[model samples]
Target: MSNVTSGDRRVRRHLTAEIKSSLRDLRNQLSMLNRQVGIQLDLKDIDMDCLDLISRHGPLSPSTLARRAGLHPATVTGILDRLERAGWIARERDPADRRAVTVRALPDRGKEVYRLFSGMNSAMDSICADYDEEQLKLLADFLRKSTDAGLTATRDLSASGA
Candidate 1:
């Protein structure tokens, strides 16, 4: 019932492969960048990720952080311990929920971490400037879809004990 031909299918497959390859490269590069930033800050990769999450999402409970970071609650506790000790994050008692504590990134420390990526941010801005609004919208949509796919894959793998 479809008019799609073999050549069209092959082209689509090739483009998909290219996209996957680029995503892999981008992930690897980001991991390397995170490691470099961690070393510069004398923090572990997970610590950096935790700080980033708090910086982006504001205060979050430990359980919420664990879910967001794809980490076990025990592991998140350890990360929080380190971040707290380093003055990168602070735990505050939730006013409405006395029993729950939320983690927040220290403003100065968050700015310090972001300083490391300032150049990359500028470069990304320049790259975006090369595209027109319509093209940029398409790119944004693709990235959002890709991120959702990645999150789903992560959940599936975790559930499967992989």
Candidate 2:
């Protein structure tokens, strides 16, 4: 019959529901935070996703950025075009590979953006500051693993669909 143990089944069902709820809440929080950041930066139409990608692995080619951002190459190109026009980023030819291009953030602008992001993050950090350093490290490790697993699942699902 069923392979599931009663305790395991209950745990799985609870965890699945919890994960969905957590994702929804996190998404909403991010949306609100992005709106705030946009207003403060005078970038009313900023795309948070693009900012996130550049913040993480900038100075990367559009193709490499696409892969890292989990977006299509053309989409990355469009985002880069806008960012470049906004004077927030620049694209330069790779020194060794003339055919390839790399995207880099304007350091001064990047610092400003980082300040905005860090302001929001500081509030979050303060909330968790009661925890000891080791405890915080463990929490970070847990979050990292969860993020990796979620990315893996998304990749697998897309591959299966293809």
Candidate 3:
């Protein structure tokens, strides 16, 4: 039989609760940060999400971006127009398919967005400095696993019609 005692179980529960609370609160804090960034840049929430997607995995087709962002193709067209007008992104012909177009974030314009996120990035760097290489690796692994779990849960929920 297992040798686990009640006191150990209580401590484990407390630790798990604290970690869960931190995770939930962190999501809200990140959302707030994004909102502030959006406000300063005069962009919408969906625009920020789409922008990040393009910046990270870009030179993507507008249709691909719309699918990823869960926005309608017509709506994406308006957003692309706005972003182009604001000098945030550019639309270029897809070399592989001359009839199609892809969107790309402007590197020079990206610097402004990074500038706004610098505070959080610096703080994260400072936090990482407190951990040794092994510990940091463990944390990174845990985070990656957690993200995979979240994606699985999201897919399951969608399948369940939730």
Question: lDDT per residue, candidate 3, 1-162, as tens digits?
Answer: 289999999999999999889999999999999999999999988888889999999989999998777677999999999899988999999777899999999999899899999999999999999999999999999899988898788768766977
- Which pairs of residues collide in model 2? none
Q: What is the descending lDDT order?
A: 1, 3, 2
Local distance difference test values of all predictions, in order:
0.93, 0.80, 0.92
Per-prediction backbone clash count: 0, 0, 0
* Candidate number with greatest lDDT: 1
In candidate 1, list every pair of residues with a backbone clash.
Answer: none
Q: Please provide, for model 1 over 1-162, each residue's C-alpha lDDT reduced to its tens digit, 9 standing for 90 to 100.
A: 299999999999999999999999999999998899899899999888888898899789999999999999999999999999999999999999899899999998878778998988899999999999999999999999999998999999999997
Worst 10 residues of 2 by lDDT: 43-52
Candidate 3 vs. truth: CA RMSD? Answer: 1.8
Which ten contiguous residues of candidate 3 have the minimum total lDDT? 153-162
TM-score of each: 0.95, 0.78, 0.89
lDDT of 3: 0.92
lDDT against true structure, model 1: 0.93
